[model samples]
Target: MGQFKVIVVGAGPVGLVLAIALQKSGIDFVVVEQRKQVPPPTAFGIFLWPHILRIFHQLGLYEDMQSIGQVMTKLENRSSTGEHLEISNSFELLEFAHGYPTMLFDRRTFAEVLMKNLKRSDQLVKTNKKVTNITTRKDGVTVDFADGTSERGSIVVGADGVWSTVRDFMRERAPPGLFSEGPNPFIAPYQGLFFRVPRPESLKPGQTVYVHQPNKQLMALVTATEAHMTTYERVPDVSERTYFSPNKVTDEDVKYWFDVPVNEQITFKDLWDDKVMGGKVNHDEGVIPWWHWDRLVLVGDSVHKVECSMSPFRGAGARCGIEGVISLVNKLNRTLNSNPDPSRQDLSRAFTAYQVEREPAARLWVHVSRLDIDLYTSKAGPASKAATFADGRTIPIVANSPVLDILPFPDEKEGVVPWRRHPKADGQSKDVKARL
Candidate 1:
């Protein structure tokens, strides 16, 4: 490639964060989104776990987030009929494990903040640009939009997401037995409707409540003025797990699981009735072996789909994508420092490093999330109840442990940790310091 420019397809949270980071570095990059404009973000709340918060701190937005986001201190549990189960100091546990509280912010607020502070001009974030084709040549990659327009860059990133067209660009280059989509290692053992509704007067602010039945569940996050809720039920796995499009789901389709009891005051139907925003999406999970082939690299839901969770942080989608972006970019920076621009081999090394460092952590999150789904949907027999209680007691202990201890990264350099729930104070924020 003659010039070092990055063409990023999709302007999701992860993509925007990458764009912002690139803009701050004065790198040449363009972001494309399929939507025509920034819409009011969906009602889901994005919970930034401690690990991701440190990433934001490096991005220079942590303090700003702390000021605007709601801080969660506890997660209360109950039976489907509103019988109280137990309350755990979830936020406190995270704080004890890391040095920061888990914060809850509307997805829309986060998007706006990223867009506002991005050093690039608004036009740099293109909209209504659905990528139709990706053509990689000896020199560079060309991205064709639905509007008969195209852009070329040194490399095209498939940040476009799960149904990513950029992923198709690598089909010819993909190594044997390394197709990005294949026998899905991850499966959906549950499905549900997620909703956003007004916060109830009776619910405590900044507190999360989870109501569960053997085959049904309800989770709500109460803010100062609104609530975001989701209800999941034990559903047999579909042959095709991921919901490829919004059109795949509809209001009529969501009614099948509508009668499950959520609380004394509300059932699934009642929750749906009061919902201001809602949608049905399957919680599919998987990890891809071929994250990159030749010039194409994936970010976000394209290559790795984490288990769905009522707690936003647990899904680990956005945070993982951000990690991918940082890892890829840092590797590229090292390569570029040695050469004006990297060759194909250099790009391959970077992509490999990105996947190697991230794969184990992604697997760990999905494994734990699967356990969560199993525990919630399993027959609530006395033994199961005891296990749930045991888990509640162990969550903090697990959180307090060093993250790298469990999910080891391939290349752990001095002064930088891959990710830690609790890090040695001396090495804390080492990555942030180096990047900033």
Candidate 2:
């Protein structure tokens, strides 16, 4: 059997999680990041559902995650004027059904836990190693970094977020008309600003609050020590919505959002004054039709960039990305276990299976996420009435969670919402064989 080393790009939560999954699978892998450090101490709060927690349980990181993560129980919806709209304990009910609570915590803390659990993290993860280009050969693939170093691996996984250099490299090698939106495809209809502050006395831990107003929306997830907050506002001009690079929040934007009322107790200004760390962001949304070609594949925001927890989807974007990792790793484990020295055809079969399972799922969530943004930002919707949660639409999606195929399924309690085992993981599925 030939040496099989997977090259993983980016070191965010999804990337780190991918590394750990690869490690647990007994697969050789390396992770490279453009940043100076592994967990760069950025990003706001994120929510993880039971589907992902199942995988974490198998990986032995669930206990650590529970230690740091706040088990979110209830969601409170309110108007800009502090009027109570509707309160839903759907999350608590989901916990009862799935045996795992929906967890909310700082993104950096999540990254830290993922990195800490990797036994060979020091040797496997490389920092400040930006990918400049890629070359695919008949035998394997080679990744070129900005630092003028290079690494050869059996396959490359792009966990890089939106504006992924690996995705750009794939575009360069793809045939004409492969990418629908040309080079930069993501649409930035809404602008986002987020930060973390000490949990307000009025707000208790484990409470997720949403304040809805016309063309503006605010979401705050209160953890033990802090409340991670995020706000989204529609960009007045459609042309300015397409972002190619990082765009900082202007002083005017900050001032405008600061004055916006969040219930009657406090305004954004109060949160801004107490912020520990915060920044502006362009909320880009898109799902590419194809996610892999030859020896290169993509994951996370690199392929499908969806709305965050600020939307009704509750960070379905990240959750979906994590599932993509599991799906991809599961296929790779099967292929390598069957034939360690897999031909390009064998590898392509695995990649095709991975994309086939994930692409449609990503497209669906992206569409739903867009609808969520429209509901709140449109004058006829949230401006007039309180936004409602679509439990029927979201619950089914969560119930059908996938786990690792090579490992034994952890014994877990199933709630009212049944957890459907992934068909592909079972030997019954012919999707991969048909593709081959």
Best-fitting candidate, measured by lDDT? 2
Model 2 TM-score relative to the real fold:
0.91
Q: Best-fitting candidate, measured by TM-score? A: 2
Q: Model 2: clashing residue pairs?
A: 97-415
Candidate 1 lDDT, 86-168, residue by residue in tens: 77775776666555567778888888888877765487888888887877777778888899898888788888776667776
TM-score of each candidate structure, all chains considered together:
0.83, 0.91
- What are the Cα lDDT values of the candidates? 0.66, 0.77
Give the range where candidate 1 is weakest over 10 consecutive residues by summed lDDT: 400-409
lDDT of 1 at 242: 56
**Root-mean-square deviation of every model:** 5.7, 4.1
